[model samples]
Target: MTLITDTISRAAITDSPLLATLAERWSPRAYDADAVIADDTLTTILEAARWAPSASNSQPARYIVARRGTESFTKIHDALIGFNQTWADSASVLIANVVDTTENTNPWSVYDVGQAVAHLSIQAQHDGIHTHQMGGFDAAALAQAFGLTETQTVISVIALGVLGNIDGLSPELLARESAPRTRKTLDELLLVND
Candidate 1:
């Protein structure tokens, strides 16, 4: 068994107490290439997304799920650019986060998709898997490859898998992975209060 020496804790330093799942969630590029997520677990994660709140229950969120080492996965991964292409191969699954505008049916479609993805991320963290969402990809090509309609947009792709050894990452990636996590304070976020 190969020993993993990655001990960096990237948990969020929130001003107030947050759910452990939300506080502990952090994107990691290093994933065990050989890891395979069970079908049930994958279903559970999608289930969480399915239940996420949508404006007037329009539920515009859609997903194109692909497992590693498959044609669909290859197409999705190939659509990625730059650093995302470098390490995303190790992830066990790549999901295209789709938003169904359906002829401008929902003005808040993108916002609803974000909510669903947030739920998915939280559930994946709870399920002991890591997720890295990327917006740097060829949306047009992915849409063509997947035969998505103009109304259906693939805004982002999610790389999901068990965490791998930090030592396995390149020095640049290691440094990025080890960097401290930060977020805007509630005070900065709240401009006006009643």
Candidate 2:
């Protein structure tokens, strides 16, 4: 068993009030192939997204999940950018998040999909699952191959699973794999209510 060390704890923040553990969350690109995400866990993650607020509650967003070792996952993963393929190849599961724009005729179904993804991200953190939200796939290829309707919008593909060894990554990717998070300060991100 991998020793429970400060590094893992560092990956998952154990402090904070509103967010008890999400601080440790980051986009994961690698995973253990032997890992099997249970159906219950996937359902929990979807349930979190299901409750996300939507414009007029039309809830047009939908998810199609494919696990590792399945042809569906291969069909989708094969469509990823070459750079992503190197690390994402080992992901235990992949989720194709899509939006149906016609569900409500609302112009912001895409934005609602974003909200749903955000909810899923945080929920993954809470569930001790790692996630990487990727936008580097060929949408046209996926649409053509998956029989996606004209009214559907491909939002993004999310890789879901446990963390893996950074050493397994190529040196170029390793340099980026474990980099610390950077964010604009509140002063830069927040605006005074004028």
Candidate 3:
């Protein structure tokens, strides 16, 4: 059996080890509509995200979720980018990650939200689930449908499910589906502390 290890050995030096895992956590628009995700599992994923570090200990992040085959889910997907809407149509669940910027005076709140969502995506992968973060969405529409308060700002939409058949995807999507991880070198990222 091929064991997929997250750690890279010195002999197996690559451009970036972090990219290996981060890239492994790629967002695929193609999802299995037939996949059934339990509510408990979804709750746990959110729970992990909730605990991520926030600036000033201000937990301003919130989420509005919807399962597939539901009116809410359909509406949320309808507001997605045309390309994303096409493939995300097959996702098993949808989650709208919102942030309360009114509670946070600093700009770090948005960065904190991104971190929390990143944690959620990584945890989802560990739980045998796949997630796609979408920025190409109508925030106002999602907020309106979910009865969001004026203070709450919608940050991103997440599509979750087991990966769908590659063949079911478009040629363009298929080309991107299995591409290897690419990133900048450490020389460009690190600074010499002389």
What TM-score would each prediction reach against the true structure? 0.93, 0.89, 0.84
For residues 1-194, write the lDDT of model 3, one tens digit per residue. 22222222211345545544454566776677799888888888998898999998898888878899999899889888788888888888888888887776687888888999999988887777888899999888888888888889889999989876666777787666645545577677778845
* C-alpha lDDT of all candidate models, in order: 0.89, 0.78, 0.78
Error of 1 at 172 (Å): 1.4
| Backbone-clash count (model 2) | 3
Q: Candidate 2 local accuracy as lDDT?
A: 0.78
| Candidate 2 lDDT over residue span 70-130, tens digit each | 8889988988889878887788888888998765787878898999998988887788788
Relative to the unseen true structure, what is the C-alpha lDDT of residue 181 in candidate 2, on a scale of 0 to 100? 50
The candidate maximizing lDDT is 1
lDDT of 1: 0.89
Predicted model with the maximum TM-score: 1
Looking at model 1, residue 191 earns an lDDT score of 85
User: How well does candidate 2 score on lDDT at residue 31?
Assistant: 77
Expressed as tens digits, the lDDT of each residue in 13-40 for candidate 1 is 7778888888888998899999999999
Note each model's CA RMSD in angstroms.
Answer: 2.5, 3.0, 4.6
